[model samples]
Target: MADSGSEEIAVIGNTDLTPSESENNLKNTMVEKGTNLLKRMEINVAEAEKRTGKNAVNMQETYTVYLIETRPVDAASEGTNPVPDSLWRRYSEFELLRNYLLVAYPFVVVPPLPEKRAEFVWHKLTADNMDPDFVERRRVGLENFLLRVASHQVLSNDKIFYSFLTEENGWKETVFETGFQAKADSRLKALNATFRVKNPDKRFAEMKHYGDELQSVISQLLRVRARAADRLYGVYKVHGNYGRVFSEWSAIEKEMGDGLQSAGHHMDAYAASVDDILEEEEHYADQLKEYLFYADAVRAVCRKHELTQFELEMAAQDLTSKKQQREELATGTVRTFSLKGMTSKLFGQETPEQREAKLKMLETQIEEGEELVKERNTECDEYVKSAWVDIERFKEQKDHDLREALISYAIMQISMCKKGIQVWNNAKECFSKM
Candidate 1:
């Protein structure tokens, strides 16, 4: 269970999926390799501690905070490594930093933070926020999240993130002073009020669809894994009963007593092994959850692209309308029906001076609209190019991570099965001796 008073925070969700040949070809022009700042700077969340704090209502409460440690790998002029810096921050602070990253780099697929509350968890893994196991898992997760962001070519460069790491005091103040949340709110309102894209990019559409599929598949996998783990736990625990029954029967037997006792001991050991197996399995499940959360980051990039496209279209439409107005002013003809045309017909033709003034106003407005349209077009192009580059990078990382996770999980399961077989085999030997 998460803390009862855990703050309800909003995070960016949306991810892009798939890569087309065209995008692959453009990768060379997008971002250069070896640009990640973390290539020189190392970041880690090494520890978690429970602390007492005042809640919103002023009552004393306990909360968990993590210690973030950062150090530069690059040697100084004297050839010595930089001294490490550490900061203690609560989980909400991580959320704040991630939220800012999402807003600041809308085109980039921001790496996801670990879950604040456990879902689809195994029966053996306690979801309690203060549980030693849960806290340890979250600590590793937070560290992974930082490493991901620090390794990003763009996100690693954020001054706010640097401040979050080094400037322990007033970091929250710095984040709020950026006014990013207000800007995000305004952007949300605009998106809500805007019309759907008239000409959505085929690639983005495909990516968005793929993101949806990825999330659904991962969610289902996690759910199934949790259920399977629970069943496995029950099976192992139930075998402990067999150990009890056999051990009691051993005392009542004559010649078979020794063999029965040995078999009972094997059963007891087999039953006890599940506690460690399931714990190990939870690590793999957490890996799966990371990608499941990653799906949202993918879609976020796609959503930003849509917004860029939408703005571009709106600007182009405005420019076109302005150009049409200029043409009507020059030629005294209305190609499209409008209120202005009706008003002009009702009031009759204006004086030459009035016409000249209107022409001048239209000309100025048309010039500005054309400029706006050009800027918007450039923005859209740049957003698409940059977005595709990050998406490609993310795809490679995702493939590698998922493959390793799945492979490790399979190996663990195989080891577990072999152990079970060995226990049974030994029990069989004991029976043969009898």
Candidate 2:
């Protein structure tokens, strides 16, 4: 007789189980098998842990699992084509198997579990062979996973998980930490080195305190310099004399130079201990540029104002002097002519026509002087008016420029404050994570 197991078997179609009953039976079988497997795995892990003095493994700790339910797009239409329920059921089974293998025999390095690999099988079943939505979802899931890993300190520190998650193959947290620390240490050392160079000749130096004071003084100086510039500019606009304005500017410049020199000398003397002198030097350089700009503006205003005032004053003085000389000349000529007439009358008798002629000539001379004086006065007034208008214009421009500079400075300060807060927040996070 033929072997019983080898005998051919055939089943005829019979109206026996409904589709829902068949699905329920499959689900029951899957639940039973999964429960059994889970029990066995737990027993094995417990035994291993007892022998090795390690904690028992748990499913949550060892594996990450995701479950998805898919429904047919046209499920509402009875006759419309729909995704077979078998495909979804098969996919679920595969996922369960994959998760089990990943947790139960993590070191085995086996090929992906066959039942859990239904996504690939599904792709083969489709004629168009594309699941764009599924692909997009998977991509998004992977990206999110990576972001979590990167942000998580524990997972990021784990060599195995970190290597698997990151694109830089074989990367380790320890190695990364070492490199970061080395860079930080090098930067610190460089800063310290700078201190040494700055303080080479000093002994028992208070570099930190000195540097702080230096910064404070420099800040005050900057403010003072700004105010000085404003005042100088104002004075120059009103005075309009290059010579006078420059003279004042020269004095201020000297004062600034002296202040800088004094600061430098102190820095040099304390160089053996001070570390941030170079920073101070850079600050001073910037302040110097601002100071110079202010000085130039003031000088421009002063020169213009002074020249206008000088012209006006000179014109007025010349007119006054001319008027006085004209009056004296007229009086002297009349007296001289009168004396001659008196002498002629007492000794050699003179005519009235001669006296009248002398008087007319004196009157003509006086009238010419008066006209010259009047013309000079008119010029003086015009010069004064032009000078005043220019002074006002210069004042307005100076004020506008100052206002713009102030606004820019304020904005910069606010930006810096915001950046400082952001940096502090990042540092706090880093510290907590570490």
> Which number leads on TM-score?
1
- In model 2, the runs with Cα more than 4 Å from the true position are 1-369
Q: Give the TM-score of candidate 2.
A: 0.26
**Over the stretch 1-434, how does candidate 1's per-residue lDDT look in tens digits?**
01111011111111121234224322322223435556666788889999998988999999999999887766544478766799899999999999877776677778888898888888777888788888888899999988887766666656677788888999999889866797678667865775699899999889988999999999999999999999999999888988998899999999999999999999998899888888788889889999898889888778778887888898888888888888888889999999999999999987889989988998898889889888777677767767777778788888889999999999999999999889889999999998
For candidate 2, write residues 304-363 as lDDT tens digits: 233333434555555565555445444543233455546655786334665466557756
Q: Each candidate: what lDDT? A: 0.79, 0.33
277, model 1: CA deviation in Å? 1.2
Model 2: how far is 206 from its true place, Å?
47
Off by over 4 Å in 1: 1-35, 74-83
Model 1: number of clashes?
A: 9
Residue 246 accuracy (lDDT) in model 1 = 85
